[model samples]
Target: MELAKIHRLDISKYNLTFLPRKEEMFAEMLEKVDADDAVLEALKSVFPLPERNTDVLLHGDYWPGNILWSDGKIVSIIDWEDAWIGDPLADLANGRLEILFQLGKDAMIYFTEQYKSVMTKVDYSNLPYWDLWAALRLSKFTEWELDENILKTMKERINWFISQAID
Candidate 1:
């Protein structure tokens, strides 16, 4: 619930804000991925995410890379440029995808379950939708810098998550 603690903060004085919906951004990102008809159809109805009761400060670009280590302990977190005030799920979704890609599906599942346990105060209906959002966030990766096998596995994982989301 570390993230939720930040969300629970009163950052109203900062005047931080984010789009009420990500439809425009996702629409443009569509061309980056080879999504099928079912996925495309699902996108149409997933807009304006099932917003939770309140918005909070988000480390929008949270992931492994942003975390700094010092003697095996987390010392700091960088990359605050993408910070925004929005649904807590947005950052959770980003971290989930990062774990899925950087670690693996099992790790991702463990991480998600742990997050859910910590975040029991909020409704979870937005989770599946956030999962889809996380999957699509990777869709915009065009560099393909990973090894062939790794890339293939990531694609399979992404597809699996997408199928789960669309269902």
Candidate 2:
């Protein structure tokens, strides 16, 4: 429904004036994102320490549509795009938002708890960063469109993300 909502909004007229230049963003990430140090430490502080036997699973585009449901339960998953070895919890953030969209915010807590019971791979506390990152990425993908409403919301969301990072 997020895509549907985006499609309904006129995305052809909007302009995100404060978006960082693509090269600048990439350069900053390259300089600051130390996968072995920064990300690992962040993950450790935010999630349960990985068990010795834990295995990394590639979850490409792990979200709701890829999650199949049967009789009100998720019975399967789909989609293989962008699937690679890393953190599956990264996808949980997106899944959380999707659940909130489909089942409402009130259901999110319970849904999240259930996910934790099953995945048991990461904590939910720091997932917001990943979720916001995904949302910002999505917004950037459509940032050049002409939709005023879409652009405004995208700008607001992206700016909000920048503020969070800065603070």
Candidate 3:
């Protein structure tokens, strides 16, 4: 479905900063991923981001778990607590990372292609940055879960996104 209308609420109301601000949490995540200073420095450079026009409502936590399907169709999107008006790519990036983690890179590619087919106004150049943002956002939670495999996968995904952002 296309987002044909914009929301009246602005992003600032959500207290949504693009990147994580908790130094301790970020440091812990970096240690878990074995991310070096260079990586952290690179991420820092992208912050204080230039203002972009908010064109649609973003499901701030868009992931497979939040989506319900029936008869091979999306029946409902259940979560709205984190919803806000912001860059639509943020939603795409969150969904993309979760799909990549659950499925694979190819599935993410397919999803991206399908999304782009309908969302013509998408600025692809900003996706990698958003992807990195999503990864970092997820890292906070993934580290706490006791599953070793999931933790490893999350680290790999975060590093991969970081590499993409740096490139």
Per-model CA lDDT versus the true structure: 0.71, 0.46, 0.64
What local lDDT score does residue 135 receive in model 1, on the 0 to 100 scale?
69
lDDT of 2 by residue, 1-167 (tens): 22112213332354433333323432344355434343334433534433322223334355566768779876666775544333444455555555544455556567667666665535444455555444433433343664777556545544454344324
User: Could you give the candidate ranking by TM-score, starting with the highest?
Assistant: 1, 3, 2
Evaluation by TM-score, superior candidate among 1 and 3? 1
Top candidate on lDDT is 1
Candidate 2 structure, TM-score to reference = 0.46
Candidate 1 weakest ten by summed lDDT? 17-26
Cα RMSDs, all models: 2.9, 13.5, 5.7
Candidate 3: which stretches are off by over 4 Å?
A: 1-40
Backbone clash numbers for all candidates listed = 0, 9, 0
In model 1, the clashing pairs are none
Best by TM-score: 1
Compared with the true structure, what per-residue lDDT tens digits does model 1 show for residues 1-167?
Answer: 45565667887676554433344445555556665666665665766555564766778777788888889877788988767666777788888888787898888788778777877776777767777766666675546687888888778877787777667
Candidates sorted by lDDT, descending order?
Answer: 1, 3, 2
